[model samples]
Target: MEFRLSEDQRLLVETARKVGERFGSAYWRDLDARKAYPAEAWQAICDAGLCAIALPEEHGGSGLGMLEMALAVEALCAGGAGSTLAQLFMLNPIFGGVSIARFGTPAQKRALLPGLARGEVTFCMALTEPDAGTNSLEVRSFARAEGDGWRLNGRKVWITAVPQATKMLVVARTRRVEEVQRRTHGITLFLVEPDRPGVTHSAIEKLGTNTLPSSSVFLDEVRVEPEDVVGRVDEGWPALLEVLNTERIVTTAGLVGTVELAIRLAVDYARGRRVFGATPIAAYQGLQFPLAQAHALGEAARLLNRKAAALCDLGEPYGSPANQAKLLAAQAAAQATERAMQTMGGMGYAKEFDVERLWRDARLFRFAPVSEEMVLNYIAVHDLGMPRGY
Candidate 1:
């Protein structure tokens, strides 16, 4: 890859950043305090016509690809909304819409894409079960073929944005693990309406980003028609991989972008804050060097994320790169937030400064979508050709 953005890409980034700043950090801070949904921010993002950046132009999108999507997300996070707005992007654009655009049958596209492109539709993924955190293949959710449809029954935990979303991308096992030749064989993906007869959600109290709620979703014999399947039944693992990898890119972009926000918060605070003999805290090398190192790590992760997204756009093997990018992005964001809080001293713990909120939000990145240990395991086995850890 050229490792540079085109003129049009720059414009997209600027526009997204402006939209994000229109809400600003104060807006997000208040939302977290109130534990309110970001209805106004969501509508504003939809009004900007930014949701369809990764879909084909024929489907009311910009005819762009994953790299552009990541760019827009990064700019939005940097603009000031942070991961709060980035999660909004994750629900509609990256997870639900992009996969449907790529793999959904024509009828499914016609039914879903227009609303998705306009941001009229919302989605929450029902991928994680209580017992199947990192080992998704262990999901006990079963979809049994009956007559012309399937009956889905199981529970999903830690699902995000469940209440507001019109749809849920449910992952279930179409066949028992022992019945399949490989552990991955039975996994299937379906697009089910959250309001369907047998589905329910109970919000899970979480750490931060209260603006976007997480929940436990219950499914009891939910009826799904053949048209609801995103890809072939029991052949959906590949599509699932695509969805997950894109999520990594989207999330990595947001984390990378928010590094700037956190760093700037600390830097500005340090420059003006003074205690000992009128000397500012910014003069201290102890503070300066860590922030500088955090900046460098953020930049490196951004480059890696871009490369992974570019590979995704080109239909190349990007699993290793995407996981690597996400791993670095998580580390970089965590470091930035921790350092920013350290720089703010007592103010960092105070909600009024907003670095504390950023700190709380960034702390979850290393665990979700994938974990740091899992990424390291993958790299050790796949990239470095080491034996898989027992």
Candidate 2:
């Protein structure tokens, strides 16, 4: 299958590149230090219409495909804007807008999509519970009938964007696990305002990605009308998996970009830092070879990412490629960041060079959204025809 981008798609990447570089490195640095949101950068992304990507045009979107959306994300990261800066798009564009476009009812779409497309509505998905990290089906959050609506009660940990989010997409169990034939059953999705009477959130202190905070969310009898539901009740597993695949593909693309940025930063530093008075450290094969390997790794992951994204847009099964792309891209970013730090030596440890920050950010992709071990398990069972290990 051909992977050449159309002129418009190419232009979209270019536009995103400009937007990503406009803030410069200092913008991200300050935000990381202060642990504050990149409010101005988010506004710039909104003003540039990047937030409208990958949604139906009738809902104030750009009518682009997932491939284009992934490309936009990659460009943003490659322009020296790291993953955290690009996460603004993830909340509204991928998780909120695209998912709603796929599964939301007409009324629900009309109520939320336009605001999401405009970046006015930010959504934080509450899926990971303290007890259910990799095993999302084990989530114990439940919603029960209450008058004409449902009352939800549960706790979610490590949910991102809770402070900035106006709406929380909650996943709750409608039946006990024993009542369901499959773990995928009895689950439902609901949208609730985070500032509701019974909802509270506390930020988690993390090592990196300080610009966007992840939180432990508490839900106690949060009430929601039927209109708040997305897709069918007790059938949210497919929808949830689809959103995870979308996230893996697009974020994999961003991870590849981080790999590229880290290599570039290291290379620039290596060329200038003289090791033996006259010879620059770039002459050392140790530093140069690892970056080269990382570049090749990122390139391969980028190809797989594009293929998976195209498959998604074509309505084909892409879980295998998506998982594979995420695995490699996450590794590539982590390796590149580590090498970048080593090449820069003491400067790398210091936040001024940005390698340390990149290292911290890159490390997260290895586990979050999905872990490396889980991806291997998936490939072994689903792709390699091996017996289930987990």
Candidate 3:
């Protein structure tokens, strides 16, 4: 029932905030304009060991829990780099390292975890295909059995960090659709090396979060050894559920951070800008009320995010809460960003103002990880005990 962060957690958040502040909004805006990666900022976070906070100490990490990771992400967003940078760091722990730490074979962990902890290697998940947007169960990618190994063939679109990733936690079907008892069954997870001969990637021109790479990945008969299988073959649907829930929670944490940043920017601008005769625009109720409302919504979303992360760390049943957190946080972030843009008036449309970039970045939250519609569906069935819509 403890609501406050521990002293150590507070320190972790403060350190992340300092690192994020060093980069500044101008740096982020410039990177977005040039469509460049935040290599320096990422390296700084690595040097601070923030990248490895959730990894086990044996793997050269601090072995922190998901709550600490969420706090760090929120702090990074609040410090001004926006959600794009927060998104970059949040994935390393939840989607990248957690899978290896939990399901990877001993040899796999020995080979990958240490390097991942040191940020020497980065990973991205390949789940969504051109055909499998929200209906991930309809994945067309197949992994055919080959002499004590497998050969995977598929094209995955909207894969993040593929160009920079050394490994991809790919989900592919091993058994044909008719062979499985259920549609969700017969799928398998594989940690495939992206640098292999059969794999090729092309970057996509994206609207926001342009600093981080997002590309379409083509896998042409990529060879995978037996050791590459994560968890068990044809039982990957369950493993993927775990990964999805974790992704939802962590991604929402980053969005909560972005909302905080947007609120701050709006407040600062309102206090500085003069509208009528003498006082600042913030003196008027019109400007102040909306900013207050944004702050309240952002705070509520932050609480929900922390609650979801805590449940995840405790190994509690978190699927519903995770979805709820993501849905609420993303909605709050999008609203806040839009309001911030409006609060800034003409300057908000300009890239130099930074809210314009945040506005673009906020739009992605409503669509990625899981969409708002999907979250509502989950709640209707799982939380409300309603009949399945689909």
lDDT by candidate, in order shown: 0.87, 0.86, 0.84
Clashing pairs in 3: none
> lDDT of candidate 1?
0.87
Candidate 1 regions with alpha-carbon error over 4 angstroms: none
Per-residue accuracy of model 2 over 21-44 as CA lDDT, tens digit each: 887677788888999887787777
Question: Any runs in candidate 2 off by more than 4 Å, and if so which?
Answer: none
Per-candidate TM vs. native?
0.98, 0.98, 0.97
The order of the candidates by lDDT, greatest first, is: 1, 2, 3
Candidate 3 per-residue lDDT over residues 1-390, each given as its tens digit:
999888999999999999888988989989988988787887788889988888889888898888888888888877777778766764566567888888888888888888887778788888899988889999989999999999999999988887777788999999988888899888999988788879988989878888888889999999988888998998888788887877776787788888889988988898899878779887888777876776677778788878888988898888887788888888888888888888889988888889888889888989887889989998999999999978
User: Model 2: which residue pairs collide?
Assistant: none
